[model samples]
Target: MPTAVYAGTPVTVTEEGFYLDPDQWREDMAPEIARDAGIDVLTDRHWQVIMHMRKEFAGKGTGPTVRALGRTSGVSIKELYLLFPKGPAKLAARIAGIPKPRGCI
Candidate 1:
């Protein structure tokens, strides 16, 4: 299990998975927290992309392909790569608050 504290509240992850307080999820603060979780730095553009990806995954139950993600984010694949050297799969997963992908673990 992994845990992180936000605003004096503790969030814990167990075999069942992570639990976070929705109230604690402020857009301004999320990028910092995401970085602490091993993500690369995020800009406002990245936040827009990450949030969109999260919504998409919630609706579909699977992550998007890089091409789709780039289209949704309005960023080119080249731009995305410059921002996320490890690629979308790793950085986006962290920003979306999803568990690290299998290979990352």
Candidate 2:
């Protein structure tokens, strides 16, 4: 595990940089996390996916996959790619401060 600082707070993260504890996540840390994940800015559309991912994680104990996000996040798969160019579900989960979505690789 590694520790990352965002918004002046230290948070534990995995070797790949995903947060180790989702409870340590704060919405205020999102922008910095997004930048670290190669997303320069978080638009409203980005937030939609982030919030939906968090909601799904809270309900299901895991982040949604790209397919699930496309189907339920109100954002199309094409647009998701456009929004998070590094990788939609992966980067979204990173910025959301949640663990990487299952099957992201």
Candidate 3:
């Protein structure tokens, strides 16, 4: 396990950079993490997906996959790519401070 600072708070993460403890996450950390994932800004659409990801993770114990996100996030698969780009689910999960969705890779 390793720690990185997000929004000036230290957070433990895995070797792949996924947070080790989702409970340690803070809403304020989202912007910085999203920036690191190459998203310059988190629009309302972005927050919609982020909130869905967090809710899914809290209830299911794991983040949603890209396919699942497309169906449930109210954002289309094409739009998901447009928003998160390059690995939508993985990047969104990172920004949402949840573990990478199962079966992403």
Candidate 4:
């Protein structure tokens, strides 16, 4: 079955795209989505870090630095890099179900 639903209905498609239904997205769904995006194992700690980064971004109008994200999530910078090899803005925004970062558009 498709993961994305539209208007409270599941969408069927065979094309490659990023057409997700925000209402169908859940914090617990991040790992599978991330893995589908080529990410490896996503732990609960990863969710904590990513969600924190999202909240910080929403509150500050900007993404957090790795060091700051680490400090907030109580994880190390090295670990952050290990989890989000493409960087926080890329991985975190995707996990948070937020629009792609400004420069990415």
Candidate 5:
């Protein structure tokens, strides 16, 4: 385990960079995670996905996958890639302060 400062708070993280304890996450940390993931800005649409992911994670214990997100997030798959490019599910989970989707690499 390792600790890193995010949104001015020190939090534990795994070697993969996912937070060790989701309970310690703050909404303010989203921007920093987004920046690190190469997103310059988190628009309303981004917030839409991030919020949805967080909601799902709370109930499901794991976030949605790319296909699941496409079907349920009100955002299309192609747009999801454009919005959270490279790896939409992975990046969105990171920014949403949730564990990485079970099947995401």
Candidate 6:
């Protein structure tokens, strides 16, 4: 298994670069992951999506879809795109230290 160095700690990651275990994730990993994902900084709005994704993934056993994120997360779809850029769900999931969404590539 490949591991990513986050804040100097090794974190297991899938071939696609998502975390292998959500439990292994730490809040400090977010910024490093965000930097790797090209997100300059994670704002409160970004946290809104990240928290929602983590919450929903824990309950559902998978990351949420972009549509689901748009529907329930406090942030809007357009804003999500602006915050996460090209692929909100995938990017946010990566930063949140969760697995790639079932619906994502």
Highest lDDT against the true fold, candidate: 6
Candidate 6 clashing pairs, residues 3+ apart or interchain: none
TM-score of every prediction relative to native: 0.63, 0.94, 0.94, 0.60, 0.94, 0.95
**Residue 55 miss distance in model 2 (angstroms):** 0.1
Q: Write the per-residue lDDT of candidate 2 for residues 53-94, one digit (tens) a residue.
A: 999999998898888988999999999999998578888898
Better of 2 and 6 by TM-score: 6
Q: What is the alpha-carbon RMSD of candidate 2 to the true structure? A: 1.7
List per-prediction Cα lDDT, in the order shown: 0.60, 0.90, 0.91, 0.61, 0.90, 0.91
Give me the runs in candidate 2 sitting further than 4 Å from their true place. none
Off by over 4 Å in 1: 13-29, 37-41, 100-105
Comparing 1 and 4 on TM-score, the stronger one: 1
lDDT tens digits by residue: candidate 6, 1-105:
898899899989998889989998989889989998788888999999999999999999999988989999988899999999999999999999889999946
1-105 in candidate 3: lDDT tens per residue?
Answer: 889999889999987789978898999999999887778899999999999999999999989989999999999999999999988889999988898788744
lDDT of 5 at 62: 91
Q: What TM-score does candidate 3 get on C-alpha atoms? A: 0.94
lDDT of 6: 0.91
lDDT by residue for model 4 over 1-105, one digit each (tens)?
234533354533223323233334466666665776678887787778767766776687555666667677777878887877767655666666554444422
lDDT, candidate 2, at 84: 90
lDDT of 1 by residue, 4-95 (tens): 66445566543433233333344555566566655556777777777876676667665566777777768778877766666665566555
